[model samples]
Target: MDRDEAEIVALLRESVRQQRMWLMVVVGGAVVAGVAAVVLLPGARLGAPLALAGVGVFLGVLITAPQRKLLAQLGLSRERAIELLSRADIAGRTPEQLRERQAQRRTMWRVVTAVTTVIAVIAIGYVVSQAGNRVDDNVPGSGPTALFGWALFASAVAGITAIVGFVQLSTFASLDRAMSAEGDEIAS
Candidate 1:
């Protein structure tokens, strides 16, 4: 309600936004690395595209956490600002108003979580499938060098999936918190 509190909320929002921008940078770098790997590494052509795609998917997972944090913070801040404005105007609140606001916030969070989860799952599955294909390409007649290349591709995909899963879990936690906050608001 106070000026100080408003300032702090603004700062927090800004910090989260900045973090999201930085994540974009990291994602771009990963894409470049994936391309370079394909071009420079011997027999890496089959693996490069898969690695790049995996990196892109993993970056989405990584960005989702910060995105959720920012959304939560922004939603709360907006709600607080509205409440403060209402108080200043001496406007009476109705149950419908409260319910609408709660519903809007809930919908926002639900959409974000559902979309991100779907994307992450699809990406993970794609990476896994690509790795399997690469392995199959390394059949006995494919030569020892191709087999080694396939092994590297599989390892890279596995590593990317592990990291993406961890990030996705963190994002899911943020979504849970947002949902809990909405529930508490409705109860009170």
Candidate 2:
């Protein structure tokens, strides 16, 4: 195997590892939420745990979307893909093809990051605006505190999404540049 292929394999392995970690988080969150829901079933605090769980699930879904597309592109299931990666098999991918896909994904993630950054800004702005509002202590989840919590949660999630996407975009951009340089050196 060439250096480029080795790098691609290593990168894919790292990606699969990260995805699995995220999956674990999603499952762990769901389990925690389930327990919380059962314990708080008779109280007004049920919504908070459930809402947090929903956000976890949402983030998991969003993060897995690119993996799903890549799986489709490679015509492999998740388990099979991981297995192939373990064996250092890239499902018949060429460096050029991978670079092209990387470029396309970088472009897509840049757009997604931009959108999420905007959302984070808006959510943070709303949270700040609501910070000074008078609170009704009689309500459980209907007070300013609850509103602030939810808004802060939303903004945090959006900020996380933006950061993740931006990091991926930057990584892909760097890899593409390195690959291009390698190709140029090889050609010369």
Candidate 3:
């Protein structure tokens, strides 16, 4: 194979490896968190989301693993392999397509992050307003303290979601810009 083909193969292998590693880390962390929540909270609902997240990650990894393996085992031509990878949603996306997808995703995430941030702020305000009443509220899950705890938890979760959304938005925006620049360079 030519140097370019060799480079593409290397990149594809590295991409698959990195993706696998990242999925493993995310799944492991989610499982640990879910188990801890189940053990600590018992009947509480905190573990549901974590369990769901872990399942989703596991499913994604499983769905992509076969494609990566087939690509390696097929020994197809480079272009054909790349096209197959693209069909599998693995790699070989044109810069224009990538840029467009990134722009759309960033726009959607921007709106979502904004809404979540606003909700988090409102929850925070409610928590602050109810803080004074928490002094005498000593019930398990049915009083001012319980309300305060739920509100605080909601605020924390929403805030973290907003932060993660913002980070994803920024990443997509940056990727869009980079792809645009790469397209421009290719065109020139």
Candidate 4:
């Protein structure tokens, strides 16, 4: 109802929208690359889809740093506004309830991160296996060797991206923990 509430809501909505857009970009890139790989590389296994998927993964990692920064800024702004309201005694009887809600949110985030880490690990394993299988199926000629090499390179890129994603996820989890701790301290 107030200006601060409106601003917080706007920022939250914007963050969600940006994240959704990022997901679309990642999915679209993977789809396009997969199609191209299938059509362009006749004998190649894994096709364009997998290759595009690798590219998509890499781009997602590249974008995550900026995304994290945006999230941190949004969180800090919101927290500071809440702190200001609490200090001014304007939040009335709901401060404890708000703290409880934030704690629940932190717990939910931890669960989400844990699930995401597992899924990412599974995806990396799947991609690696698919790449290896494709490389093995190709005959022992120069062309096959070249294709295998390209596939290997792409797989490596994807692996690095996966690593980055894991690291970012961990960083976010830690940030969440730290924020929760700080919130608890403030509430006390």
Clashes per model (N, Cα, C within 3 A): 0, 0, 0, 4
Return the top candidate by TM-score. Answer: 2
TM-score, structure 3 vs. true = 0.48
Model 1, runs deviating above 4 Å? 1-3, 44-188
Residue 74, model 1, lDDT: 51
TM-score of each: 0.35, 0.53, 0.48, 0.35
Displacement of the residue 155 alpha carbon in candidate 2, Å: 0.6
For model 4, residues 23-76, the per-residue Cα lDDT tens digits are 888777766875687678765666356765787677877756555675476555
- How many collisions between residues are there in candidate 2? 0
Report per-prediction Cα RMSD to one decimal: 10.3, 9.8, 9.0, 8.7
| Cα lDDT over the full model 2 | 0.73
Residues 40-112 of candidate 1: C-alpha lDDT, one tens digit per residue: 8755445457765786787677766664565465555556554644554334556456556656765665665
Model 2 CA deviation exceeding 4 Å by range: 1-92, 136-142, 145-148
- Candidate 4, superposed: residue stretches over 4 Å from native: 1-26, 29-32, 35-93, 123-188
- Candidate 3 per-residue lDDT over residues 20-136, each given as its tens digit: 787788768855775676567654645245876687777786757765665566555557866745655535666556667766777888898999999899999998887665433
Of 1 and 4, the candidate ahead on lDDT is 4
Candidate 2 residue lDDT tens string, 1-188: 23354564565677777788878887688667656655565344445667667886788787687777766755667786667675674357787777777778778998999999998999899988887877677866556444455577669889999999888877875777888898899889
